[model samples]
Target chain A: MAGENMVGTVAIIGAGIGGIYLAAELGVAGFKLRLHDIDDARLADVRAFGGIDVEGERGGFAAVELATSDLRAAVDGADAIIIVTGGNAQAAVARSLALLLRDGQIILLVQGNTGGSLIVRRALDAAGCHADVAVAEMDNYPYSCRRLAPARIRPIVAKRWLQIAAFPGNRIAAVHQRLSPLFPQAVAAPNALYTGFTNANAMLHVANCVANAARIESGDIYKFYAEGVTPAVARLYEAINAERVAVAAALGASVPSLEEWFDRVYGVREASLVETCQRLTYNSDGPYQATGTPSSLEHKFITEDVPTGLIPMVALGAAAGVPTPAIDALVAIVRNMTGRDFAAEGRTLARLGLSGTGVAEIIRVMNEGFA
Target chain B: MAGENMVGTVAIIGAGIGGIYLAAELGVAGFKLRLHDIDDARLADVRAFGGIDVEGERGGFAAVELATSDLRAAVDGADAIIIVTGGNAQAAVARSLALLLRDGQIILLVQGNTGGSLIVRRALDAAGCHADVAVAEMDNYPYSCRRLAPARIRPIVAKRWLQIAAFPGNRIAAVHQRLSPLFPQAVAAPNALYTGFTNANAMLHVANCVANAARIESGDIYKFYAEGVTPAVARLYEAINAERVAVAAALGASVPSLEEWFDRVYGVREASLVETCQRLTYNSDGPYQATGTPSSLEHKFITEDVPTGLIPMVALGAAAGVPTPAIDALVAIVRNMTGRDFAAEGRTLARLGLSGTGVAEIIRVMNEGFA
Candidate 1:
């Protein structure tokens, strides 16, 4: 309503679980949609089939008018481009999207960690795409879906209160006014920083995986959350949450209690962190269990979470003179587990244009944005 | 033989699994022994049964002679007092032993941490028990066994090359000479610091427990070591080993590779850590698994290891200007799971009498045993 702009044509990049699910929703909603992915076979299958078969929750087969591997075909004439991929995959998408990004286009990164928006912006600028795009990031994806097949997704759980924020806090209204049609549940967060620290994916996934390393390695079939979130583990989860909140406070951001966030998103109202974890852990029939546990720590729990989720927190905390002992400790252990220097390789405070910046400066930069 | 004196009478404190096991081993060796524990019921059972029922590799029932709860009577005429309780329980034993300790008494702290010798020595000094005692500690116990009943122990595996070091490095030969009948395979370690850092129980137990937290919490019974020792976890073990070795090097002590130690203790000849873990883990019915995984993180793996094993490593590493990031990280995660400040609560550099001491001074203190 603010801009009187209807984002009719949207490009959904990355044919992963999130990508396919988003495309199905938009395609079913009667929006002109283009789906792009690096996988050639997947694109061909979707094109040959005329659309993806979306099942579960609200089931349907929605026609994707354009399904292509070509960047230009996907982005041309598109008002908005949503990158539904892991933080690691985002850079490659940004690298390719830079060449075809159009002026006034809106780019939204789902579950972007700190500096995620900045990295894409830099890539676009470096590629000479001088598109005056409104780049935004959500704290998490709106749906928990898994790929039933290459051209199909089973929508497991549709989450609520998804938090999205444009890179420059000022552009949030315009971005929200346009994309709200697709994501009606998403509310505008304060800024990119707010969404970055608000992410709970890494906090929940990493420790559970690490603690359950033996079980996962043994090739035992079991629900990940319901059984995994024991009272003891829930206690550990609280400590990590406290560290994250402290990091946010150091950067002049107030994060909602993880318990509160869990209740809001997953609908558990337990006051005790352990009790909440215990309740949700064994809900094997729930949306989270559909994905199953990763067979190895080499999966996203260590790979994506460590770099995107944890590294940024540590870097931000260090830049602001905060002692994130617990976060720092987990990072140290994980680096050895994966043999990767996440601090050097992941999204960092310096990359977020926040190095040497204090709380007030970080807040100011987040509001104004770098790109 | 420095003293040319045999330790005629020995006092075995703590009627727990290890204490009883040691008393059984020593009692079978035809040495005059007295067993003490806080639990009178356990002591009475051992006394009422006449001796502990030892069944396993070398099965036999040995008379315990006398078992009592009276600490004074247990220590009055003992030439040697052996404390075989956990790292955490060692302090209280030292506190009680301070009052009864006399000259020419050799106190052996089996598997005592770096602080073990120092704490007892300090307590004795404070109590004006100016006894010329040679306090020593073994890197680990000589055998892997558990108390099947209050008066029955089922030995799982008997290990060799038990590393023993007295508080004073010069006293190593003397201590070994005196206790050779009890531990024939024992060798002189560099010092108490060497034995302390060489402890691999926590390193193996903590990571495995933490990694397998989900499985343990779910009430699913599974083998801990063999099944728990996955490829990803093996990598973490190596990282922890590296940090520990780094700390050791900083303190001018050379530590063994965890792989070599496992091979030596468990007789697994696999070169790779993962392979070794796989080989050792499933021996579920074997000696190592006899200890089994704790039902919760509240067990010694977190409580004692974080403070005694990990915290001290980090503290010593910091004192010697070495970075123990991996050890620190695991400690952080475990602390949250258990909700205890291991660094403050457990054996620390300060508790070990090396708080402000530098590398040279620490080495010096190790050579010239305190008290």
Candidate 2:
């Protein structure tokens, strides 16, 4: 109950799957919750059911103190605000919250795709919000969830471990202390740099998606990890993963190799990456198995992962003097396939307000505000 | 006809589909033909049958003047030497013929995949051969034929037109005059540079193969041109094709685009590349439809095309100062997937003995031999 008193009143932005599940779990844990979403029909559905009926892995008829579309009312006096919107909408949410956030409020991104917190921090500064707020981000969402209805959430699986870090990184300990009660499996990372580099979706999705683009477009129904990731495709995954590891090391963060990460998370240790992915197909109970193959090249696997995931890694690699030919090649192929310029639209060092900064200075800026 | 006295004797090298097809067509046309193949079993099969049974498009039972494994005996006193071994075996065939070849003999490569003539000429020099010889190449093989058995050949579909050019631009008309009696559809180009730039396999195979790699590895049985070239994949094809066109333009060679080439060759006038490929599947008679999907990553679609096809184009691109990001990206992905250094192993200016030469000089060398 370390955070029971400190994080008493919490606001959950985005009434999507992650937000709804968080509302039900926090409500059943005896904490006050307010939920907000821009979609009026969604809010209406939630109001009709009174609150979320949390199911799967945890059971409860949890109630929320308030449900509205108003940003100000949702975070008026809340001690913490958790954003569950995907990376595509994170910046806009941060911009909208710039004028409404209060002092001592904490904002945690459920999953900070590479440099998520840095993006929000920049957006808040651009909007001229002077609130003394701490921004934290997790490496990935802690739950694989679905909204059965607007007011019903089924958390398929809760991850065994989660990595969380705060902007400037100096306030990670205090932030971790307050968020531990909400996510018992959460562990403190040195900074958002570590959490951002720990993003697995970037390394796993784009190459496999592009490699299987025709299979997806032709409406082939097959297991994404088991069948889509062939031996050669798996080798490509390893090649890109090596570039990601080198970028993280150049930025003073040491993360596990993709194999080690898969071993730790899915517990599928095999001789090669292809075998590991095949074993993950049948072994990792529900998370990867439930992941549907993208029907088109426009799926989040490429549209979201390429710009937000691979683009940022390429930018960071350029900043740290690490050559990322494999990553750059993936980005180029995606751009050619989609006819979109992901590099220009992606989150680069300039977007993160760290353009032209050296490795040491970039690390310092990541741990300390630009001011 | 006209070439009956000018080209009375022909030497057909290799016992593969192309070589066997060439032997039957020439023998039936009333020319003496000598067939050579290193494989004794293949030559034995030919001797057992006493000739080639040409089936499909052209039907005939034709006899050869001599069938031998010895290189010297095959080309001795022959007016024309046609090398039908694929691009992979062309250099060795050229080296073996260097000392054995007589003065004023013409050597025609059925399908000189990018820079085929240059490779053969270089191999000839390295072997210390001093002989008066004229080297020529064709844009592509003339027929989509297969060997039904050791001595049985099926010419599925013969191309409507064939482009041929000699090593030195001054000798193309003479070479075309002597070869026209055997191939009435033959057209003369400026030099090997023009014929080499017209190679279509390099522009078609590698990108589509890489895009549909997973399907190929998973043993998916689908029409390669129709099912494999989806909309997104077709866009990638166009992107890489543009680089090839630009490289040709930089070298002062005006070539038709991939779409236009298909229109001229297949008579399929579709709006987009995807539709053209789809139409080609059903409308191109038997060539594209009969093309099977690759069964493995090691198939010649990649192993041969990437090295002999795209690699040479990439090297030419660098010499011409054209940026081939899309082509380079495809090369990088294939290299990463297969863990092979295609750039170093492929045809380059250095391999052609034209390193540091400008676009104009490279073109000059392609037209005029080093002498």
TM-score to native of every candidate shown: 0.93, 0.94
Candidate 1, superposed: residue stretches over 4 Å from native: A1-4, A55-58, A146-156, A277-286, B1-4, B56-58, B146-148, B281-286
lDDT by residue (A217-238, candidate 2, tens digit) is 9998879988889987998998
Candidate 1 local lDDT, B101-194, one digit each (tens): 8877889988775557776666666666766778898888787777778778777667766788888777888888888877888888878778
lDDT of each: 0.78, 0.83
The CAPRI classification for model 2 reads as high
Instruction: Indicate the docking level reached by candidate 1.
Output: medium
lDDT of 1: 0.78
Q: What is candidate 1's CA lDDT for residue A190? A: 75
Error of 2 at A18 (Å): 4.3
Error of 1 at A194 (Å): 1.8
